[model samples]
Structure formats: C-alpha cells, structure tokens
Target: MVTLNLVIPCFNEQEVLPETTRRLLTLLDGLVANGAVDASSGIMYVDDGSHDCTWALIEAFHSRDPRVHGIKLSRNHGHQNALLAGLLSVEGDVLISLDADLQDDLAAIPRMMAEFRNGAEIVFGVRHRRDSDSFFKRVSARSYYRLLRRFGVNVLQDHADFRLMSRRVIEELRGFREVNLFLRGIVPLLGFRTAIVKYDRHARFAGESKYPLVKMIMLASDGVASFSTKPLQWSAYVGGVLALASLSFGIWALSIRLLTDRTVPGWASTVIPMYFLGGLQLLFLGVIGGYIAKIYAETKQRPRFIIERTL
Candidate 1:
C-alpha cells in the first residue's frame, strides 16, 4: 500500500480552512475508496502561527478524523519555512503540498500521483493560464521566470509551491542547508526525473494575498542570490567595463594634448567620470554586501522556526 501525505502550511486562513478541509477530505476518501492510496493516507496541516481560529479548526478536524494531524509553530515564520517544517515532520511514500486557500485544484492530485507513479520523482502542478490575475501580476510573473533563467536559477516557469514529491526526492532536498532557501530554484537542482501537469489557477476565495509586491521582490532577490553566483560575476564585469572606459578617456585626452598642442581643461568631463566611477564603486560594494549578509546569517546557525504547540 502506498502512503500519501498532504501537507498544508496555513497562516490566518480561518475563512477558507473549513471549505478547504472538507474538499481535501473528500478527495482523500475517494482515493482510498478507489484503492489509489492506502487507508492510512492522511493530511497534515501546519499552523504557521495564525492568530485566528485556524488552529482550533484543525484541532477539531483531527479529533473527528484520525487521518488528520497538525503542527503549530511558535511564531509566524514565513510560508517557505513553514512548509519546510511540515515536510520534515511527515513520513510518506509520496508528499503533496497545497495552499489552504484552495486556489490550486484538488482534482489534479490523482493525475499528479499517476505521473509520480510513471517514474517522475517530482510532479509540478503548473498554471496553464492565470486569467484571474491582474495585468501587472501577469507581466511581473513572466519577467520573474525569464530573469531567473538568465541568471542560471533553474525554476519551473509557471509553477508555485503546489507539487508532488517522492520520498527519495525529499531525502535529497534535505541536503540543501542554505539559510535562504528558494525552493523553486533549489528543487530543480536536485536533478530528478520531473513532470509537469498544466491546470488553470483560480482566484483566492477569501483574504488578500499574503505576498505583496515588496514580498515578491524580496523572494526574487533571494532566489537569484541563493542559486547563482552570476550576480557577483556581473558586478565584476561591470567594474571592468567602467575601468576600460576611464582608461579610454584618459588616452583620448592625452592624445589631443600631444597632437593639437593644447591643454584641455574642462570641469564637466572630469567631474562626470569621477561621479560615474564613484557610483559604480558603491554599486559593487552593495552587491558584495548582499552576499556578506547571507553568509553572516548562515554563520549564526539559528533555528528556522519554533513550534509552540501541536494539535
């Protein structure tokens, strides 16, 4: 019998939890009845320090169904860390992650499992189209994936956290110990047999998206920095280009002075190069500082998140 575990990391999702759980239970029941998964298959909900009745609801569900289990974090760790904590806790032959808001289609799970059985270690539930998103969001998402690929960050173009992972793939993912974990980038680096299932994404049922524009930018920056050293290399290339430009200017000034027999004195030309070089220096320093900050964070060896209680 194949044991399948569904891990949901929820933050203040009281409005959507009841419906999400009910739908998920129905899916699990169907899978068991059809013998696609063992009767012991279960759902594990990780409460990421929700202030609402999210934990209370999960506890109620657990009491009613022995197949339901949960973990409560001590504080509000971000979504990625919360998911990681849940993944670390569960033991299953195959693990699936879905949002508590139910934007991702539950109907796609069985198909994802079929792909997993077809020798795919990781199955991605990719969005075929995001018609529900605004124009700005659609453009930004496309740009994000393009930029990540250019910088050598391997990532699924239209995939979020919704996916299926075989237990062996999970074991490989455990080796990545970086403090800034961009799972979308890191997962592709595992080099496992992977497949994608296209599905139309739905709008959020309730509550605004937790990922605002600022948070999305931060995630993009983290993804670029964590997966590739191309940014640092680009900084070095830009510095070299600036140096060459300055040298060319110096040569031109000297040649004009020698050939035309005139001392060319101009504040505009000299001051412009000085300002440009100064700004370039600062930019390079900032790039180096970002990497230094990441190193400092890792050196501290702090726990990702604390678990206050479990129900």
Candidate 2:
C-alpha cells in the first residue's frame, strides 16, 4: 500500500484544529485499516505565521499522535505558498492538499485514492455543488473560473487546491520556480493523467475565511497575468482600434469644415474624444504596469517560503 500524506495549510485555525485533527486522524485510521494506504500515512499541517495558538495546537496534536506533523513558516506567505511548502516538505508516495476548514469534504479522500490506484496521477477534488456558499460568492466564483478559461488558463472548474498528486507529479511541480505562484493554473499545465472526484462543499467549520474579496481579486489577477499575456495583447488591440476611430473622426471633422454646411462644435468634439482617449490610455497603461510588476517580482528570486520550525 502507498503511503498517503494530507497537506493542510492553516492560518488562525485554532477554533477548528481540534475537530479537524480528530476527523482526519479517524479517516487515516480507516484508510489504513482498509489497506487503502499504509499504516505509516500521516497529516502535515503548515502554520502560516498565525498569531493565535495555532502552532501550539499543532504541537499538541503531534505530541498526542505521531501521525500528526507540523511546519511553521517564518511569516504568513499567503495560502498558495503555504500549501506549496507543505507539499514540497512532506514525504509520501501520494500527497493530497486541502483547506484547514472542513469545507473540503473528507469523504472525497477515499474516492480520490481509488482514482489514483486506477492509474490517475492527479486526482482533483472538484466541488460537485456550491450550495453552501452565498449567492454572490457562488456567482463570482463561477464567473472567475469562466474568466480564467477565456484568458486561456486551463483550470478545472470548481477545483481549488484540494487535490492529489503523485510523488513524480510533485517532483515535476518543484521544477516550476516562479515566485508569483497561482497553483490552480500551474498544476493543470503539468499535463498529467488526471481524474476528478466530485463532492459537496460544506460551510467553514470555524473562523473567518482567509480569502476575502480583495485577496480573491488579487489571486484572479495573478492567475490571468501569470498564465497568458492576453490582457497586454488586448490593451494593444484597444489602442489600435482607438487610433483608427480617432483618424476616422479627424477625417469626418475636416470634411464637415471643407464640404458640409453643418459646422462641428469645435470644443465639444475635441474635448470629448480627448477625454475618452486619455481614459483608455490610462487603463491600458495600468494593465501593462501589472505585467511589469510581476516581472519585477520574478527577477528577485526570493525564497517562496521559510520554515521556521517543523515537527
């Protein structure tokens, strides 16, 4: 039987850690008992510089059960980096990543393992439905995935970071050294034989969501900018279209002055086009600037995360 490791990233998850620990250990026990995974299988928790007793609770779990492991980052490096840290650090034949909250159903674990045994190297735990989410969240999330697809990002819809990767897949993933990580996009690019196990998402067991609206927007921006230059290309296309429109307007104005009896209002015509073109210029510049910022970040080659301690 292959050793299975669950890599969960935590930030201020003190409220849910106890129950999360209990449920996961029980699940692992069941897997081991059924011979689905080796008895040596375990869980690794990455503490993303949470200020609460999150690390201490992890230590407590580790003391009580050798199956529990912990990796504390030097600082909060966001969820994607923290998850990456755990995946790279853990030792197992297969690795499954999920959130600290119980939102990602544990029930899908066995189904994913079955898929893996059936020759799937990457088993994505896709949400079957988002009935637990608010209406705005459901709409926005659907739109976000659709937007990524439009920008040519090959991502599995309703699949977040909750998925299984074989050792070879994780090893290949390590070769990707970009500092601005959007794993949701990067994983799909790995081109492995993949499978999907659908499960209903539950509400957060406890604590506030780590991803607020602002962070979600930033993640979407990163997903778009990292995978495709479509935004930058669109900016150029817009500029070209505007230029043609401006030339056509100039010709129309000149013709009115020369051949037509109707007089064009000089200030209104000039100022309106000027304002419109100016706004478009600023908008495209902002898009270009976003790409430049990503370039600047990638050049520094800073370590994505630092492990302050591990247990």
lDDT of 1 by residue, 1-311 (tens): 68999999999998988888888889999999988999899999999988999899999999999888899999888888899888878899999998988899888899998998789999999998978889999999999999999998889999999999999999988887777878888888888899999888887888767789999999999998888899899999988998898999999999998889787777988898899899989988998999999989889888887877765
lDDT of 2 by residue, 17-86 (tens): 9999999999999999999999999999999999999999999999999999999999999999999999
RMSD over all Cα atoms, model 1:
1.6
Global Cα RMSD, each model: 1.6, 0.9
Candidate-wise lDDT, in order: 0.89, 0.95
Question: For this target, which candidate reaches the highest lDDT against the unseen true structure?
Answer: 2
Best by TM-score: 2
Clashing pairs in 1: 74-308
> TM-scores, in order shown?
0.95, 0.98
Residue 148 lDDT in candidate 2: 91
Q: For candidate 2, what is the total of clashing residue pairs?
A: 0
Worst 10 residues of 1 by lDDT: 302-311
